[model samples]
Target: MEKVIKSSDRVKDHGEVFTPKRIVNLMLDQPEIQSKINDLQATFFEPSAGEGAFLVELLKRKLKVAKNKSVSAKLFNTKSLLALSTLYGIELLEDNVEMLVMNMITTFNIEYSNIIQEKFGGKVNQHVFDSAKVIIQANMVQGNTLEKITSDGSPIIFSEWKPVSGNKVQRTEYTFESIINQSGPTGTVQGATEEMDLFADTDFFADLQKKEPRMKKYALCGWTSIYKQEIV
Candidate 1:
């Protein structure tokens, strides 16, 4: 005969899961938000990006706006694709981060490729491929929210990221150069040069404030829920 287990002996699980797309839409579609869209610079931060559902929708909306305005196809195409530059996300789980990154790349590639074909008559080369790759990679960053620190020193953000499973915690610093290096010389080709200057500036705090003076005095903690949690 088997004995029944007591409630005290059982552990409750609160598994991390992706946010539903419908819920994400509702949050983004609030009337107050709709009115503020034009005045705002379009930058977005998702503390828990889980599979990038919200990001994908945001991109679609930006693209629609560009297309409807009769903007130059080249400028609109680049702008639509560059909208990814406004996105930022963090995931606690490595697997989840990888999944989100892959999805982001695939989604952006589909739109970017279509734009290229429509504009350039089916041209396929390193420039187009590299541009698409750069946009996708820039939008998604993989790191634990708990282990990051904001520009200000109020509270430590992303301080809980752990790459290894052990008693001692290890921190990993990732840079654009590191990632490009790992790509193993695939980016270098005669007449296929791409500037690395864009990746050199990783300080979002300075870049954002410079573009919009209203954002100058805003604390870094106000930018995302993760930092808000840290300050509180």
Candidate 2:
């Protein structure tokens, strides 16, 4: 229930009207949607994630699976991390973006902390916490979905964060156009005008859109590293 209706002037200015939770649930409760959303690896996108009301419910639904009797800390962390990472959002207002990020991240952290304390009486692993934070930071972006670019005019590149070898995660970035193209390199691809093996990372497609010579073909960047200038 997140009703932040602005003045008529503001509404006219931005076309902003919050969707009531009742409607959100009715729309999302379809049999197919219920099945798919329950899956731990499923991805969701909300181009207009006002204060993340939808995301909050989505996270709650997914965390039920993480709360099983014999669940390990690793299981909880991975499942929860995947749930958050798989969510993609684009918000036009900076304040709304901040609220969305804070709401979602805080929900995850608090719920995750409680689950671990009750189940295992232990604190969250730093690696897992940092990894989850990074995923939230990258997945919930500030941009215009229609324009498909950030406020700074960079292509809205969404990163897929996956659990890789031995507890670390691999992040593969994809532009909005690349993701919806259907016939491009869907997951991580080597940068060349040649073939690369494909794997499903959500429903996104990607390509080796060339630019510079310095960046490696399949390099993973640090949490705050700028995108390679070539992708510009």
Candidate 3:
């Protein structure tokens, strides 16, 4: 039998309890939820993703859809990554977050290898694996979901990967809070103005101009190369 609780201390402190596989399947079996699982691009976010049990099952279903829609190795690679990109999660405990990432990566790689052997009859693509790693790492983050911030108090950021054309994707970053508030991306911006020199020969009025925060967008790149962040 699977161990659902790690320890009594964890249970008391964080209420950490893993859902049983049977229960997870039954819950996901509902008609409306199963319909979304069949969509290769439908995004799913688990606010309390302990060890990623739900996300893993979701990935498995999406991978099946990807396989059904693919007729070649290249098409399989593209669709499988697209499926991987749609699953996101947040785990409060660091240990659970580590396990969550591991489980997700393992499940995805195993499915990839299986498809390659059964359908493609060739070596699995390393680029595809690397890209999946990038997606999993970005989508699954260790944070307090209710607070919308990471353990260190910084805002949690998630990347949005949009397939633009062919195998190319456009990447955009959005803070968890911004996403919840429907505001916008909290992008990399220049630091606040340097300490006012009061005595330095400077254009006082020019120095007073507020530095607008610029939102940066990654240039469109092949889905297999998303690990490299190239700004536009």
Candidate 4:
């Protein structure tokens, strides 16, 4: 077992072993998985992103592709969003979670800086960096995946970020259970009464609207611009 944490007591308690870099790379080198390493729209999920070993490699590969496709900051940021936003991870320990976020955003900023200097004559907007940080913060979380509950005891929920027209992004939140039910091998939303209805497909918004929380939907602008400070 690879011991990432120095404390043996904590390791015993949390089983916090991290996969070594060599193993991680070997596993990701499989032809099918390697093919999509730089595919901007492809998604990645790491259950325990300890210091983001695998995730960092993913960012490196994706940013390499983005660097190649750098025509302008606008086009590059829009495409880079797909690569950055599609990554998701859940870490039980808060420190691990924070580290994972740091790992991701730092890699993002460094890569963005490198590519801009190499291809775009070092002229780029700060908003692009802000956008990457925002996406990384939202994507990684500290939570118990087995329990599938947020810290507040609510069902785990993840937001989907979609790039809309006019350089804006649309965010849609969905319950973890709902997402699995929709995509599971069962190939059907066939489940108990607590589950979302398959019949609700046609009237999706109506059902979603009637729900207690009123499905969280938001549109974020300012992505078209360069980052000055923070995410709006």
Q: Model 2: which ten-residue window has the lowest total lDDT? A: 208-217
- In model 2, how large is the Cα lDDT of residue 219? 44
Q: Which candidate is the best by lDDT?
A: 3
- If ranked by TM-score, best first, what sequence of candidates would result? 3, 4, 2, 1
- lDDT score of residue 140 within candidate 4: 86
Superposition error at 45 for model 4 (Å): 0.7
User: Which of the two candidates, 2 or 3, achieves a greater TM-score against the reference?
Assistant: 3
lDDT of 3 by residue, 1-232 (tens): 9999999999999889999999999999999998898878889999999999899999998998899999898889889999999999999999999999999999999998999789888679898999899899989999999977678655678889898877889888887766887876664321334444657698775554422223457889998887776787
Task: In angstroms, give how far residue 75 of model 1 lies from its true place.
Answer: 1.1
Candidate 1 Cα deviation (angstroms), residue 62 = 1.5
Q: Report, for every candidate in turn, its global Cα lDDT versus the true structure.
A: 0.46, 0.67, 0.85, 0.69
**lDDT (10s digit) by residue, model 1, range 35-148:** 534322356667767667787777656555544542454444444433544566765555666778787767666765665467545443444345445445534556544534
The list of candidate 1 runs beyond 4 A from truth reads 1-15, 35-40, 114-129, 149-232
Q: In candidate 4, what are the lDDT values of residues 65-174, reduced to their tens digit? A: 76667677667767676677778888888788888999898888888777777777756567777778877877787777886655544455676776677766666666
Model 1 scores worst on lDDT over the 10 consecutive residues at 215-224
TM-score of 1: 0.50
TM-score per candidate, in order?
A: 0.50, 0.74, 0.86, 0.77
